[model samples]
Target: MKAAFLIPLLAALWPAHAPAEGVAGDFDYYVLSLGWQPGWCRATGDRRDARDCNPGSGRDFVVHGLWPQHERGWPDHCATDERDPSRRDTQAMADLMAPGLALYQWRKHGRCSGLSAAGYYAALREAAEAVRIPAPFDDLPRDITLPPAVVEDAFIEANPGLTPDGITVTCKEGALAEVRICLTRDLEPRPCAPDARRDCSRSRVLMEKIR
Candidate 1:
């Protein structure tokens, strides 16, 4: 369904009372952010979690979060009522998320998505599947250094629907952290808003090894 139609249809079917922070479904599109796991582990060093840091994990980018964002601002934790995510919903996202991230993401961001747990997660999975990981990035032979723009270009080149403005490269301590891609709620590429576009000021950043 078109995002324009789906948002209003959802709103009418299940009216959401805005939380103290802001109204649910007030956002314009979604940001499907994928974290470079090795960079994350290396940047944090000792603070790394077991799943992502496991030496033989053979993982590269992992789902960071699928966020609902406005053109200029973001709404988070917008649900007035809290409910536990079903185990089925949590398990459905397990392959894409690290341990504990599924729950945290649902509470912190998904609740504000104006979608039921099943619908929201299904959309998230679809968005993640829509993008193709650029070669070498999908499986890096060794740690390499590249400009943030290069990383963004790689993704844009790999994913037919993406443009430079539709994606932003994020870094932490000069290491590639995440690639945040803007998409309409229905999962079509679009330019990220100014707020979502702001990130990683460094001229170059490290792309850590995937072992």
Candidate 2:
């Protein structure tokens, strides 16, 4: 759905920094640090799912970054109508967002995002939607391979109590760096609790289930 506006502009740019005593890091997917999502933010113009009267839309995803800038806002003034940035708590805006921009920046018109040597923030919905298809990269159908056992056999032929987990992927020379999946169902974690998230379609039936 237009990638849903990069999920509320990256939940309003991670302004809440609370974790600095005994230092705990490594939460992965759902916030708590480890910023960035998804390689250059994806979405570079598509718009074809608007139906019903022929409106034709869906493809305006964005998540550009530069958190904690020097007070003036708009990442030190680029447009200034305030695209994103403003809660007022400065340490030079948390030391200018602490990093060298890589992940957050997926636009599709007037300009797009680039640069990601893969140094930081690159989860990218595990590849897309439900997650899976990793390992020597065999699923090469392209257009962004998102085949976790065909979405768990189309959700067990359309919900039959849904029981499908067990994924494991690992490709070498072909590609698909590495991927380990897990599942148990019962989830909804978006913006907040739904059991705090889990069923990634049972982690795409556990990566891609070869075992």
Candidate 3:
């Protein structure tokens, strides 16, 4: 009877331990996150020090990350045999994301992509180029408060193939933060996974003006 009882108990516990280690390049889709530069600088109090936050940077929305996503969950820090990115490799992405972020993303998410450092960064650039930034955000003269859905709608309107279900807007401290869009491995738009479709439900959120 003890053997029978132990067998059921172990079966119950197996699933909890099964997915602790993710397999590289084994994901269902991708999430391309675009951050609002002005909101990030204001929220983080990064005035003149950071390159992207400095005056005359002329940046609005910048690439935050290109994350591999499962249909229901995500992976990170998976074990991989790929070589880590060199300093020069990371620096090449400075125009879109910080060098530190490029390095960190490579170690955490990129390693799980089953791509070499060069291949992963190249894919990141391709993903960023797939989305079009809505024009209104380029010339906002002052702060504005709007529902996060409006932001999602703007992105959908700008990108011909993107839909409301494929994009989400996130908020931070009652301010507009980032927009996350779902894409297939080939970089085509797709509906986000249930767990990944996080919409900021605030009735209105602050969108800081460009500095």
Candidate 4:
């Protein structure tokens, strides 16, 4: 009985490739840099003027957030990245930063060397947990119909672990679906989510329909 349960348990907890070590932390920092200040800037609001609200276009992605919805990408800047980073190269963000923007980086975690904990981490954890199986699909409402991107993000949020190195989406247990997502450099920190996650409410209806 234990073996039977353990098999599915392992499957539920497992990732296809296990991200590189130490790089998980690095990838996490990358996520942090993005969530705080996303790099992608597409022209939003006022087509007549078509002014850049975030101005992510042509820039490397920097911020992403699930709070105001992850779709907005990075608008808020971290307290540390704003002040310092592991290596200082103004060329990377000359257009974004001012002549004297405070710059700081933790080097390992993209945080400053020493500063009080901000609990801002509470959000990034979502990205970490999204990379797992049997995540919180039933909790979200089915009526909402979350997009694949949102569902994938949720899986990583629910079950975070050792990210892997390879990147591909093939048919697994369910023959459900697949979508290409931008992966990390070496699959450290194992950013992965389950094959399927729907608005919990919608999944419930699906279950009913199946029944």
What C-alpha lDDT do the candidate models reach, one value each?
Answer: 0.82, 0.25, 0.87, 0.29
Candidate 4: stretches off by over 4 Å:
1-88, 94-145, 148-187, 191-211
Candidate 1 local lDDT, 163-196, one digit each (tens): 8889998888878899999999888999998778
Q: Could you tell me the lDDT of residue 196 within candidate 4?
A: 15
Which pairs clash (backbone N, Cα, C closer than 3 Å) in model 1? none
Give per-residue CA lDDT, model 3, range 121-209, as digits (tens): 99999999978999989767789999898888999999999988899999989999999999998889999987777658799989988
Which candidate gets the maximum TM-score versus the true structure? 3
lDDT of 4 at 171: 24
Could you arrange the candidates by TM-score from highest to lowest? 3, 1, 4, 2
Residue pair clashes in candidate 2: 68-93, 135-171, 136-171, 167-206
- Pick out the ten consecutive residues of candidate 3 with the lowest summed lDDT: 13-22
Report each candidate's C-alpha RMSD, comma-separated, in the order given: 9.4, 17.8, 3.9, 15.9
Judge candidate 1 against the unseen true structure and give its global Cα lDDT, from 0 to 1. 0.82
TM-score against native, each model: 0.85, 0.19, 0.88, 0.23
lDDT of 2 by residue, 35-137 (tens): 1112112211114231211222111111223121111111211222213222332122223232222212211110111212221123222222343222333
Candidate 1: Cα lDDT at 20: 32
Model 2 segments beyond 4 Å from truth? 1-44, 48-102, 105-150, 153-211
Where does candidate 3 stray beyond 4 Å?
1-20, 45-48
For model 1, the superposed segments whose C-alpha errors exceed 4 Å read 1-20, 45-49, 80-82
Candidate 1, residue 164: how far the Cα is off, in Å: 1.1
- Model 4 TM-score, 2 decimals: 0.23
